[model samples]
Every structure is written in C-alpha cells, then in structure tokens.
Target: MGNSSFFFFVFCFIFLLVLGTCDCLSDQEKDRIDQLPGQPSNVDFEQYSGYVTVNEEAGRALFYWLTESPANRDPKSRPLLLWLNGGPGCSSVAYGAAEEIGPLHINSDGRTLFSNPYSWNKLANLLFLESPAGVGYSYSNTTSDLYTFGDAKTAEDSYAFLVNWFERFPQYKHRDFYISGESYAGHYVPQLSQLIYERNKGVKNPVINFKGFMVGNAVTDDYNDYVGTFEYWWTHGLISDSTYKSLQKTCEGSSSEHPPVECIRALNTAEMEQGRIDPYSIYTRPCSYTTSLKRRGRYPWMRGAYDPCTENYSNQYFNLPEVQKAFHANITKLSYPWQTCSDIVGGYWTDSPLSMLPIYKELIAAGLRVWVFSGDTDSVVPLTATRYSIDALNLSTIANWYPWYDNGKVGGWSQIYDGLTFVTVTGAGHEVPLHRPRQAFILFRSFLENKAMERSSISI
Candidate 1:
C-alpha cells in the first residue's frame, strides 16, 4: 500500500478538487441514518398499478414491468421511454430505481427523496423494466419460461414485453416510443429496436412505434470497450505511466491471444472504476471501491461509488419491505441468482455483444432517428469504445463534430453521422443522469423536441 501512496494521493487530490461542493452527502455522518423503523413488510408489489405482468399462453411464465403513468407525470413529456438495466444479470429495479433515474435519489438519510426533478420521468413517462424473465420482479413459474440468456432471446422477450405491455397501457400504443439502457444494453436496445422495425413493416398494429434511442457510457463492443479504455486511462494519467506503456506493448498486441487478455481487461477496468471525486469534499468513496473517486475523477456526475449491491444502498432500496423481500426471493432455486454480478464461468455475455447498431441501421434505413451519448470522463464504457464499435458499421458519411459547451467550458463533443449521432456529455462520468442530470435532461429534451434527431433536408 505504501508503494502506491503517491498515485493514491494524486487520485484523492483530484477528486476533492473537482467535487469540492458536492451537495448529496451530509456534513453530518453520525446523525443516525434513518433506519427502516420496522414496518410490516409490504412486499405485496404485485398489487401496485405500476407493476403489469406479461403472461403468454405458450409458457406459464410470469414477467413484470413497473410502469409510471405519463398522465401523472409532468406535462413536459413526449414519449414512453423503456429503460433496461444492464449486467446481463443485474436488476433494473436496483440501479434504475434506486440510483440513476426514478422519482427520487435516496439520500443517506434513507427516508427522503432528494427529489430528482431531473428524473427521466420529468421528460418521458419512465418504465423501469426487468426482462428475459427471472430478473427483478419478473419470474418464470415453469422451467421453459426462462429465455436462454443470449442476444436473440433477450431481444425476443423485450419486444414481447413491449407488445404485451402496450396492451395494458393502450394510451401509449400509438404514441412514439424510445428504448434506452447502458452496459450490456449494447445488445438489448438495438436488437429490440430491430424487432420493432421488422415487425412494424407490414403490420396494421405496431406496439413499439419507431422513435430514437439513447445509450450512455455503454458496452457496445468487446474489442473497443476493453482495448480503448486502457488508452483513455493512460492519456488521463489514472494508470501509472509505466503501467500504461507496458499495457500498450503487451496487451495491445493480443486479441485471440489468451492468458494476456484477462490482465489487459483488469487494467482497463481499473480506469473505469476510478471516477472523479474531490478529496477535501468529505464525501468519501465506498469502502470496497478498488480506487477512490479522488483517484479516478466519485465521478463528478454520479458523485460516489458504493457497490450498488451492498448494504450501503440498503436504505436507498431495501428499506422498503418490498425491495427487501425481493432480494431474498427464491431466485437461485429457479437457476438465476438475485445477483448484481455473475459469479459463474462464462457468466452471461462472453463477447462484446452489442445490440443497438443493427437497430440503429434498421431505424436509419426506415427514416427513424438514433443517437448515442456518453459522459466524457466516464471510464466505465468510455467514448472511444462507442466510436470503435460504430466504426464496425462503416457509416458512409459524417456531418458535424464540435464542442458542446456548458457554463463556458467544453462540456463534451457532438457528432452527426448519416443516420445516427453521438455526443459526449463533458465533465460527466457514467450514469449520465446521476452525474449530469441537467445535461442529460437537455439531451433527452433535444430528442423529444425533434431537433437533435432531425436530419438536414439537404443532401450532398
């Protein structure tokens, strides 16, 4: 530990300086965090209007969606946005509800909402969905109900979720819809979007009306996300100069080359976990965070890193009996763990299996719009990775690549391709909303207002 003190100090210093004025954590840590004062468990989540089950006759499967009504939402809405949590194994209820965007951002106090006026619900009626069954509140009564955890199965079930979910909320049927997610969603959003486009081509009934999609700091490609991230850490000075140089030489040279890939993967993952934080801010990173927020950058946008699965988020989530009960729900007996990470070999996604590129291409060909945005400082799924993945498509044209300014600083960059656009939300890390809510709100509104997704009528 002493040998690494210099790097650690530098990391701490940077985090403190960047987030010197963080407002989330308290000046008070000892004031008895609001514990769950022992209320009878109301895990009767099945009764809530927000939860709509999908039961197909072919299989006695049970899946659920938490639907927040657009009518109850602010009138500023435009479309019904479906958000899927990634991890290929994680639950959207955990991340989408408790952390990033929902009705609230629970403070350490546990009983309050730092009411996220910036919640995506502020713009579009938000749907936090758990899909492929056996995830979150979704379940399979029969063995066959669980779709094989793969790109194709995920897309099928997700598209099915939309088709059936619309049956319950008929109002949103004809209204425009958008698909979005992060991490493993690189496979989800695109594949599901393709399902919508393909099925809608000849149909008198189209459940997922074509609209734009959004992804942030996503895992869209294997080679790019894994390889490109190391370069980012080195360029940003998070990794030691020697380590970075050594990585470039040893790891950069291999792809199919085994034994060395895991080393490269770890080195790159370090850069992602190290987010922005200010040392002097008094708001510390989580106990298990491999690096400090100060060391990496608590990502100025999200502001802290407590492993989402830990009791640190208990008050934020499990404080409610419904959440607590769900955590212990008999999932593993059904062959899936209530997991935040995969412990099994080959876990879930063995490849950088991204989904949206095909969906984007389908949408572009059909004249629908598509966009992908990232928080510039996020090492989680850095911007270069997105770029390299999209390059796989060999998009034929380019339009604008310019700095997007906020508060007179280069907040990030925005670029337009033939049919898709990518933007970097400057100064932000992963979970763009938690980190840069205002900017994320602005980006979402741009898509809703039909300005950002609209292509110039003039053709070259």
Candidate 2:
C-alpha cells in the first residue's frame, strides 16, 4: 500500500530440490504412516525433530517434515505453508530449505550459519516434503516399491503424507494453508491442490483451512513452454534470427522428446548459423548468471550485468555435509540432473491439461483471491507459454497489461482480472525466491496482504 504495487499480466517460463528429516504424526498414526514393514526403529516421528517416514499404500516409503513458519515466531499467530519440490524425484526440504525458503544456510563449512536473508518460511510455517520415492532418503521395503512415479502416484503419496503429518501436528489442523512448488511441480502442485480442494469439497479436512495456491516458473503446459524457448532466445539475443525461424519450423511438435524431424532441422540450422552447440537446446541456462557464462560478442546498447547465484545454488547448498547428513547423506552430486523438474521416471503426469487455472477459476468463483507469478528471463517455461496456456481458459481479464519495475528498470510485466492475477518478477529465473529474493519477499507481502500483482508471464 505504501510505494509497492501488485502485478497483472501475461507470461510463464520455468526450470528447476531436497531432503531428509521427517517428523509430524501421532504415535498411533505414526505407526500406520510408517506403513513400511521394517523402516528403521530409530525413525520416530516424536523423538526426531525431522525425518518422519510416511508409509504408502503400495509405493515406496517417503519422508517429510514440517518447519514452523518463520513469520509466525509467536507460535500462536502463524499460519502454515506446505512447500513441495517437483521432480517426482526431488526433495522439498533440500530445495525449499537449502535453496529458496526456510531458515539457516548450511554454510560452506557444512556446519555454520550464513543466514538466508530471504526464507519464505519466515512469513508462515513452512513444511518441506520429499515425495514419490527412490529420491532423497525416501524408501520402501519393496524394490517393486516404485509406482511408475506418475502424477497419480505423487498425489497419492502427498495426500498420505498430509494425513499422517496433520495427525502429528493436530494443533495446526485449522491453520490457513497454501500449496507451492517449482519445475515439474507443474504436475504436483495442482494435483495436490485439487486433492486438498476435493477433500474439502463438502465438509473440509478439519486439520486445515485450505487457501489458494502458488507456482514459480512451473510447467503448466509442455507444448507452449517448449516453443517459448525460441521466442525467449530471440528476445534475449541468445539465438539468431535464422535460429529462431529454424526452431519455429522444426521444433513444432508436442512431443516432450526431441523436437519432430523438422524441429531437429531447425535446431541444426540455428546451431550452424548462431553457434549453439547443445542437443537439448530448448532448455536455457537455469538463469541469467549462467547466460553470462555464454556471454558472446558486443551488444553495444545492452547492459552486461550478471547474477552469480542462479544455476549454481544447488551445488552450494547440497555440498554441506551437515546438510547432506541431515538427509542421511544420500545426495551424491555437486553437479546436476538436479531433478527439481519432471521426475525422470516412467511417464509424464504434468502432461495433463489440468493446470491450476481452472482450479484458480473455481477458487475465485468461491470468492478466494488467486495469484500466479513468474521469473523473467527463464526460457525453460517462458512467460509466453504461460500466457498462451492461460488464454485458453479465457477468464475475464481485469488488471490489464502494465510494467512491474524494480531497480529503476522493467523487472518484468503483468496483467489481472477477476481474482486471478499473473505477475512477473524482473531479473528472476525458474525459481523466483532463489533468483530474486527481495522481489519474491515483496510478492509474499502483497499476497498475504491480499493485494495481488499482475504480470505478463511466469518465468523459469
């Protein structure tokens, strides 16, 4: 309300999580949630502050834990924000805690506190969850424990985690809640949200008050997100005119695999002319910092500013042994396949047209406020794709096109209408909090205050 403004606008893009240390569930329910046959005897929901194991119906056992919201230090006044990391294979605690939100930085020393200036949990209780299985410390007594790891399986496991988790923290049963995540979560966030909304469809889950939802640089639609990379490349000077045109022609199919035969040709042409060398070329450098690495010839009129934290954050956070040991030391890599996106499992679940827009529309119809946001410069799930995807619903537009500025520059853009508002965070990539903490904080403030921003697209 002071000098701050809300966003309403157009696009979406995305890119790429974490953890062990589960806790939260009643002793009786804990016994059931530990539906695992021989889960470690030491794994007690009550004895441990984290690492509470959740037993699934027929899938691998998963581990999840809740951290009280950073904002509600009073304990009596704080609300709960359950955080999920995508990658039907990733861990929320690792990404949400180590990278984006959550308190304490597991310093390079692996045992020191650098203190993250921007942990979203500060505003509300943050619950980090590691879903699916075969990823992180989550496991199962059965090797056939893997359930094809699709959207259905993720929602099922997540729902089970909630049931057990809520039983543990019975006091938070009526707390206000918001569902959030990144990357492949395009599939997870909505499925879980729908499940929550459905469970509360008639009488509501007494354990909590379901609020709206949030996704950052998420994959709402695979088609648009894929094509958007070409548009973003052209706009950002990363691809030449020839390359852009070639991509437009060749990479025109909906297949998540290689672009169609024509798409390959376009890529080859672009590579030949513009000098791009990667095979999976549609994906961008997780963010601007990485783009800076590919910095090329002079753009006399362009600024050379760069951000060092973009793509390297996971390496920074997970390298800490204390952080690693927190999850019982399973995280192995310093590089990537940082599976925060679609789980490299059996099938594509996010492939469903079932994004949150319809769900947001339903929530809005019920008089709830809804906000969608993105990070600019993220070609992975570009803003253009978000706009294209949302336009299909054709929801009534309210806060028409405008600029959301920051640092005296056009950080990005926005648009709004009815209760659904889409906003873009300037200088951000796939993960908004990780790339633009200040802006992300400003966003949370507006969201909590009920003043949503409108942007042109959600970026990754």
lDDT, model 2, position 450: 69
Please give the CA lDDT of all the candidate structures.
Answer: 0.56, 0.57
lDDT of 2: 0.57
Top TM-score: which candidate number? 2
lDDT of 2 by residue, 270-368 (tens): 545544322112234324433433442111101111223422454445444554454333432323332332233423333344344576566668765
- Which residue runs does candidate 1 get wrong by more than 4 Å? 1-77, 111-114, 142-148, 240-287, 290-311, 314-316, 322-359, 396-399, 407-409, 453-460
lDDT of 1 by residue, 242-281 (tens): 6666656655544421427555555545545444432111
- lDDT at position 283, candidate 2: 38
Per-model TM-score on C-alpha atoms: 0.70, 0.71
Span of ten consecutive residues with least summed lDDT in model 2: 296-305
| Global fold similarity of model 2 (TM-score) | 0.71
